[model samples]
Target: MDELTRAVVQLEENQVIEIVRRELKKGTPVEDIVERCRQGMEAVGEKFSQGEYYLPDLIMAGEIFNSILEVLRPIMAEAKTRKLGKIVLATVKNDIHDIGKNVFKGFAEANGFVVHDLGVDVDPELIVSTIKEEKPEIVGLSCLLTSAFDSIKDTIERIKQAGVRNQVKIIIGGAPVSEELKNWSGADAFTRSAAEGVKICKELLES
Candidate 1:
């Protein structure tokens, strides 16, 4: 593991920031730095799955990743490339958990996707309205609680009822989300990892 990755895994905010600045000064590619940080986040997720870390730790990892993005966003904007696609993201109703959602947002932005984050505990109506207005090519729903599965299904159903379901592909993500849940919720795909979710979104756009 690299210093930057280790610093992030340790949740050492200051050290991670210092390493990022130092790396930028050394002319390191911003994407490389971001990848290392992402690897760290992946490690944190693995730890959480093993019960070595908890919700607070996961939240801390997201905050640290956001801080890294803050440091890189200006440079990223200066070197802006054509956007890959548009995505409307939300944490479903009755579920306020946003760590996964925020992480996915960060990765999506870094990979050239315009993500309209609808924030946590989002109403299905709001999501449907956003889809109508944003006309995003993809919709991403996030939920950490198993109980929120209904909210995911409801949101998708609402989107279908609103007649926009055919216009956009839907992807759901969270600790408990799976192929079964994706099928049950009527989503096109599902992921537990933010990185994988971004890849899936890219595939959705291409296909």
Candidate 2:
């Protein structure tokens, strides 16, 4: 990889916000840098899918991706009249692992989502209450374990039970859930990887 690609890849690995800003000052096009990051994430996702990389590496890549986004998000915000949409994100109950959660949050934020993170081991009731209070357009339920998939289910049911199911889109993911599981849970979508998941959410938000 060249300097720009290296910077973006390293940026995703290191979460170097300053490095991205410096590259922007070096006359690198923001679009180019963003695209480079997309490539880096795709590569990381591929590695994960191939079992060549573990969860920590994936999460680290996410940290890097979001760090640069912190610098660019304001620029995008300033240029655009409105963002795609706000979202509430969290890892569900009994799942203290936040590696995937952080990665997904990074992807969402980098994709221009204003994310309200509920943090690890999040409760279904709390997730519902946040929607009632924040009124975000999307609810992203993140679980890193098959054991924690119930939290995703419980969270979705709470949305229906609270009668807010019609108001917000629910997207679920983590280590074990599938698109079919997402459907089974009555969620709008399930993404296998963070970057592609953001694409789906962005497309849905735009539509």
Candidate 3:
């Protein structure tokens, strides 16, 4: 990666706001740096899943991500595209885990997709309601608990019942979930990680 991208990677790896700020001041487009940071987080996640890293490291990265985002927000506004399609994302009701979702949100946003994060323990109906109002092209449903997975099923059914299923593509994830659940949920696809999820989302959008 280039120096700007490396700076972004450092921001995600360490969440040092000042480091990214200095890089941005050194002539990197804020967008390039932000996207690079998101990629770095994905790399960290890949390593973590492979047992090369730990949760504490991920937590530290997440902290750095938030810190840099604060400085990059205004710069992002100036770099906005015309429209890249919207994606509405949420954790199902009863699931509070969000590290994965947070990482994926950054990836999606960096890729020119407008992401609406609905936070944790989100009810299906709220997701459905948001879909109706936002009319997003994609709905990203995340769940980290096996018991709380009913929320994912119910949300899809509700969207179908609301007659927007065909209009929106669904992507599901989090631990305790599998391709089987994706098939069962009638979703377009399932990915083991946020990195893969973003890839699937891009494919779905392009296809």
Q: What are the lDDT figures for the candidates, one per model?
A: 0.91, 0.75, 0.77
From the highest TM-score down, the ranking of the candidates is 1, 3, 2
Q: Please provide, for model 2 over 75-122, each residue's C-alpha lDDT reduced to its tens digit, 9 standing for 90 to 100.
A: 656654456689999888888866566666665665567889999898
Residue 149, candidate 1: Cα error in Å is 0.5
Give lDDT: candidate 3, residue 135: 91
Whole-model lDDT, model 3:
0.77
lDDT of 3 by residue, 50-88 (tens): 998787877777777766666776666566466577899
Top TM-score hit: 1
TM-score of each: 0.92, 0.75, 0.79
RMSD (Cα, Å) of model 2: 3.6
Native-to-model Cα distance after best TM-score fit, residue 89 in candidate 2, in Å? 1.3
The superposed Cα distance between candidate 3 and the true structure at residue 126, in angstroms, equals 0.6
> Model 1, which residues run further than 4 Å from truth?
none
